[model samples]
Target: MSNTGSASFLRELNPNRVEATKREALLENPGFGRVFTDHMVTIRYSEGRGWYDAKVVAHGPFSFDPATLVLHYAQEIFEGMKAYRLPDGGAALFRPDANARRFRNSAERLAMPALPEPLFVDSVRELVRVDREWIPRTDGSALYLRPFMIATEAVLGMKPSPDYLYCVVATPVGSYFKGGASAVTLWVSENFTRAAPGGTGDAKCGGNYAASLAAQAEAIREGCDQVVFLDAVERRWVEELGGMNVFFVFADGSIQTPPLTGTILPGITRASLITLARDLGLTVREEPYAIDQWQADAQRGKLVEAFACGTAAVVTPIGKVKGRTHEFTIGDGNLGLVTARLKSALLDIQNGRAPDHYGWLDRLF
Candidate 1:
């Protein structure tokens, strides 16, 4: 067998496990990204040695030098996925292979070495297995897994690191929205642009998210839940929110989303919902949507619903939109039928409450 085989990786476990009582208590109210599981997975990569030292160890802080390459040049990438406690009390992952592939893409874009897909998936699987007890049992809740890679080389140059660390840590999370599943209002950010052509917007890197924080803070200060950014070139086309992809449902029963044109992040949730919508017999369109057209359509009742989708939020309805000069409400500013139906369908499949006709779930236990 290969040295880095799944069995070898599994045998390297040294779990500093969390106490059952404390873990259970945290699971009871595990807010998003706050509480973590007992164990984490780590693998090291070097220019000559390749990937080595794979292990599942206790979750804790890492020793980082002040001049670490990632801190200076930001050579890092990450993927967000979840492990669900099924209705039958088993554990499963939702399209982890997809995440593995995307992680490779992000690594390539950021000038980082791509960890083998099998290794990536196996690392996540073993960590989730060791931390299975941390999976939250609350409804609309799961163990949110974050797999990230960072350049660990202690250099302050403008080049990629020669050494890297890939790690996976999981946190049991409750509903992403604090109070409940209510519609949200969005603030259009005409002043800031998320990404331009031939940029890192499509890559799932920390820099892109860091660039969006100022705009997101602006939205929060302006009495909005999220900020919607436009395309960088024209500044008129609707792109996406800070961390999620936007979808619009028209009055004619057609669903539209901004195309993945190297400027917007290709969201896994957005892609899944597109397939699910088509399977439900709804027309799915991938085209550029303009901010002004969104305002006009919502005002004229042509746009029935608008929602954002991501790994964290899943499907969130956009009720009210506020721009500098234009403002409108979509479909009575409530959760539209299409939005609710799509959300329920995706969640059902994810939680294993519905039949796995599409074979999306990877049964881990």
Candidate 2:
């Protein structure tokens, strides 16, 4: 399976597919990642063979051996992106090349084989093409794509596995956060940290999310919608949410976000927002923001709006923040002007409502 080069995937379509009626019923309210398409893309990788045996096959479970390396050592990586529905019933992918580059970077960080970026993009394109019908017809609805790689060698070792299995699966999704465009409350975790300076925090891997479940549960217990982690070193600087990057909007029309200083996952949506913000002639700064400062500014009306961004969540406004003994609400405790404007701009480009000046859409149909 070690070919490291671009290879066309063989087609093995699903025969016992779901009828359009049932699929349509499911798509009507596919909350998120619940209803999947019929087929998935899979590619095999070996130590010396690189990547091979690429194909689109029926979506189902794999019989994992008891001694699978991924089960033991947890050497795995993944990427998340979406194929949006176009005006003419076509579908377009947003910044797939960026997702591909990030996938390669995540694989390298996990000590796994570097899957060729072209192959990664191709796998996603092929999967969406095969499951185009799975894409929702609504403007904001989409077919969420998950491309992942895991060490498949059946060995009881602590080193990197020689065999890997790469697969791409599609799910019809509406909104990531149930709150939708409404502002969300965040619970600051004083007891836990998400990522450190020299950690896998920047990589799109399962381990990071696995480590965040406890804090997320704690947030839910504290009556919050999401968990925001602080810097691992001093625990004073704001890092990011469990799965999204955050941005702060000031009353002076300036925007700031925690810098990508090797501790935060560089989100594709985050980058796009920065570009769009700059295009709007608003000053954008990548700097460290402390929790105390956030509360103080919000209380004094210096900070007007804040939002979290990611491939899944897109741009979600942050209205309230709650820590151990402190809580403050952003401007009016509602969706701020800047937040709504940016979200509309981003969704417009994604759903083909506005001109894609940045050339971000990769048309799939």
Candidate 3:
């Protein structure tokens, strides 16, 4: 499955099939990532041919050799974003090009072939176009898109694969908060680190999440909603949550988030929140926020609100920070005014209720 750069070819699935009732039932709940849409997009890449064989096919499994490079060396990268159906029946993607750019960056970082921007954008557009109805119109619901690339060469010597595969799959998702937006508890993981200095933390890859799952399981057992990781070097400065970026609101009506210290995932929603905060006339700072500093401020009444931001949850308030022997509760253990306001603003822009001042919305249809 190699492609010549100038060839215009896409193999369409002959069956073109879907189970209607089953899909409907799944969409009724559409719990995140459990069920997939009817169709998926795929394109192949090789050392000599680049990316080719772009096509939309029925969602199904792939047959891969046991010696596939990705199976051994894990030369893979992925991204997460969403598409929303607006009131007018049209669909929109929140800064999809930004995701595309980040996908390319991740590929470069992992020594995988960069899927051309046009192909990447077109692949997403085609998927959304075919599966537009799968995009939920309910509030706080969307069609979650997962785009990924895997090295597919059938040798496992650890060198970059001569062949690669890039794919996009989508799943309808309901509100990340099962009931409603509520304050969450976080466990400080002083023993385990999600990413180390000069690591793949900045990339949207699966290994990082896989590495954090153990610590996340421990946090859950400890009655915390999420795990907060510290810098691997000193285990002092706060990096981020297991899957999201952290922010702090101070008594002085200012905001602070851990700076992008090369060991943190520069979340797309995190950057947008910073921009929106500035637009809302709030003082915002990005620096090394230490765990000690967070506790000290909570005691001094300076840390008023805390939250985590990601594409999945949008924004969630952090009600309490619990460590092995210490616990600090923030702002009555409820969603603060600033946290609620920011979440609403971002959601409004996402749902097409508020103006997209930053030109973040990209219409898919």
Candidate 4:
């Protein structure tokens, strides 16, 4: 719903494309964000002119000045979504309009110009169409698309850039984590908070991720796969994982997650899972969950299952939790019935293995 007028994209094919044989070999075992497609989409925005000069060109890098605003001030935001290989031998995207709406929200929060929703979807459509051959048909594999915006103006002052670049690049991805769907252990961070009220924590920005790396490193040192953050004010409530939203399953067939209060990212996948869980007639609650209460519930068998959801990782079961002075395992430290049911329901519709009753799939030839 942005005011930027319609953009007419110009296509420019890649002069040096990988041969089909090599491309096939790459797609066979293409891990997450490692192997990219041949082409990409780029659109520019100026303070006065709005969005302009849209193009689909060969995949490559850009040469920017050292004073580039994004490099110095970290004015950037990005979204991750996927294109699925359908059962009928076609490609489709899941919930792109939702991504577009979130993208605009991120732009506004970062003091950047908004791109029209139609242009955003059209740009993705163009790039995916140009590189449709790269869509992988393997289980849990698809073309992962990264749409991002960066402040491009060269300056030294601390302010929003006049020039910005919006681009979409895709990679053939099989799994986000090396463990695949196997359960992951989380290290609870009492020292670091992900976002505070009136902060960029709710926005999908580069700074927010950069802020989590230190806590993530600490987790890895503790032999954990990921880091989970607590609320900034209290440091008692569980907010979210470093990059994904978390949900807890109880024995009564109820689901609960940390609410969105301008401090947690409102994940599209998390929203979808909430809907699908409720569709099964289960009660899903969006409320504050304390870390100590979580461990207590898990120990007493009140919490049966817990999982994290996002675009790249999909729905990942969280098995164990570790902190400075406490450690506990959830639901026998294995995938539970509720987690599996929700995951299957989401992935089945995504991969076209089952009927899409919600009309979530936007199929492409």
How many residue pairs clash in each candidate at the backbone level?
0, 8, 0, 0
lDDT digits (tens) for residues 298-334 of candidate 1: 9999999999999999999999999897789999998
Better of 2 and 3 by TM-score: 2
lDDT by residue for model 2 over 1-365, one digit each (tens)? 32555678899999988899999999999999888899999998888777889999999999889999999888999999999998888889999999999998999899998888888888899999988888899756888999999999898989999999999999999889886788899999999899888999999999999999999999999999999999999999999999999999999999999999888999999999999999999999999999999999999989999999998898999989998967999998788888889999999999999999999999988
Off by over 4 Å in 2: 1-4
Candidate no. 2 TM-score: 0.98
- TM-scores, one per candidate: 0.97, 0.98, 0.95, 0.98
What's the lDDT for candidate 4?
0.92
- Candidate 1 runs further than 4 Å off: 1-7, 10-16
C-alpha lDDT values of all predictions: 0.90, 0.91, 0.87, 0.92
**Candidate 4 error regions (>4 Å):** 1-6
Candidate 1 weakest lDDT stretch, 10 residues: 1-10
Locate the minimum summed-lDDT window of 10 residues in model 2.
1-10
Candidate 1 local Cα displacement, residue 200, angstroms = 0.5
Ranking by TM-score: 2, 4, 1, 3
Ranking by lDDT: 4, 2, 1, 3
Those runs of model 3 whose alpha carbons end farther than 4 Å from true positions after fitting are: 1-16, 19-22
Candidate 3: residue 94 lDDT (0-100): 91
Error of 4 at 258 (Å): 0.5
